[model samples]
Target: MNLRNIQYPFLFEVPVLKHMAGFAGLLKRDPRGWPSDRPVVGMFLCLDPLIFCCQPQPRPFGVAHHLATRFPDETFVFLVPITMSLERRVNALALAAQHRRFQKTHPRASLIILANTRDEERLLRRLGVDVRYAPQNMFVDEGMYHPIPGRERRFDAIYNAQLAPFKRHELARTLPSCAYVTKMFTTWSPQLKRQHLGKFVCSLPYNHVILNDVTADDVVPMDHVKVNRAMASAHVGLCLSGLEGAMYASIEYLLAGLPVVSTRSRGGRDVFFHPDTTLIVDDDPRAVQDGVVAMKARALPPDYVRATTLRLIAEERAHFNVFIDGLRGRQVDRTDPRWSFEYAHKLARFGSISEFEALVRAR
Candidate 1:
């Protein structure tokens, strides 16, 4: 798929130097104003051929350079948002180098830099690239989908995700009185398309099921406003996604002050905290039931849960903002102790932080 087709507006072009007196001292200050004219349209280039076993290869550097160089001529801001990992910084630098070389060759290009992860920010800073960070573009704000007060809610739990063999095996039986939210329309997941069709066929006379997909016109997954409201109204929000990336649902649940019941799905674990605002359980029916019961019996304080989740989001956003700033020719301050220079240097110089941390823990 052409990633450029899914375009987002590129951002944070105003130079940090213009905002503050000193380049180094800019790190201590917070940005107050933004450019009224948002010019760049963020682009994510899908280079499947440049990927090796779900990992990006350096060969794509050539393609990224070409795209970045050409994008500015069209008056669109191009951005590359990658998943956070050890190789993230390395990959970012490789791509930034391409952009830099292209810019040097063609000095008139209107190239803006944007990245979305902590490691990416550190990499851009080390490379001395004009980069900036943007909020990971997660549209899960609580203001959009909030619960209606004084109105009685009929459902106890809302389960939204794909229905596959494993998910069905785990949730074959139903919890009493819970609203089982399923998709009304099936999407293009080759692996689970058939399984989902079979599950929908068989999942009758079991419990109250809300069989609706995002594709369905009638069913609307809680918008940002409804999301907040749902978290407050519903006893629990359950997600059994077999795969994910920073599940927006989890963030929504947290922001809504609702306890989340989720499986140990990949990105789910990266974000959700157990017993804090979310209950991470294996794909076991009994475990899920018990978790829901516990959540229903005694929900965490709304203020405490909201505060904690909001704090996490804020930190994540800060790291995100710094990354974009670096891409837009604003490198992070290496003089600041709080900067991620030490971590990046450690990772780049010594191979892997996990390996180092493990060895240290062993001793």
Candidate 2:
């Protein structure tokens, strides 16, 4: 099928499901050259509009290069670069190779890589990719994830990461009371989801709660509302990744009015971190646990955390707005609360393209 005909990249299919996802040893060969063949994130292709994709880490199997090759000349593209200063699986050499193909295949198509941190911007620039610093988490839906006043904080920390090794879940194993609102091949068969999640749950020492558990009952991975409530029930949120794209969970935690304990690493997940409510620690179990304990002990007000983080997020959004306005040759009023793109994080949250557009219409 022609990717050009496919308006929604989420629907991109591989030859088979087994070869689609690069992780969990699902693929027979290295996905370094081409990660998930399936469309794992939101992407759009059109004749008139500026083509865009909220690409996740582990680049999707030469898909971007295909877009460059197929799209009309001088098509503009924006990408949110994954922070991968150090992670064996995120082969920068392969990423560079795929992107170099993207540039060569469509030399006239201008692509702007969005970075959460200056370091990431520099990294992409070194790779000969045009980049700008704009924390993508600035677009998270605050309406979906505000503090629920009545819920008591039950878990000391909740990690909203997918079950990938690069996410570094092992670091959080020692935490006394934690929650895994994790997503592990949630689209796969129930038996497979249950088999792996059961083992993972059993391995964790003090997991007060585990979302998407078929081991306990037949619960699929939650939608946004449930994830927000689960986050509210935790005293702190955790970002354990040593490298990744803007871990959307960091901003999700702050928006849910929870203080965050994050390991210092690449990828600008910490861009919106409130200095008083957030702590960055070494990538050690003891450090992570201690940081969580300290943040929890501070007894910071939930509203304060939410408000401060929103302000920081707003600043980043405003910066991005100016840049986009320049590109469009007209201001689109992006900061207007009712603007359709206000909560574009739905790109990641919504599984289907129709669901994403419907929510956009509702707003």
TM-score for each candidate, following the candidate numbering = 0.51, 0.73
lDDT of 1 at 357: 24
Q: Candidate 1 — worst ten consecutive residues by lDDT sum?
A: 46-55
Off by over 4 Å in 2: 1-51, 54-74, 78-90, 186-196, 216-219, 333-343, 346-363
lDDT of 2 by residue, 1-363 (tens): 543312212223223431223332222221333322343455542223464555543443323444444434545564544543312223444455555665675677666666667776666677776777766777677888899998987788898987645677878887888887876643545555565556666787855567654545234577898899899888999998765667778888898889999998766777787679799999899999899889989998889999998888777666766675566556444455533233355334323434433333343
lDDT of 1 by residue, 229-269 (tens): 44454577777654433445556565666677777764332
> Measured by C-alpha RMSD in angstroms, how accurate is candidate 1?
17.1
lDDT of 1: 0.44
Q: Candidate 2 clashing pairs?
A: none
Name the regions of candidate 1 deviating beyond 4 angstroms.
1-77, 82-139, 162-169, 182-198, 211-233, 268-274, 301-304, 329-363
- The prediction achieving the highest TM-score against the true structure is 2
Question: Judged by lDDT, which candidate is best?
Answer: 2
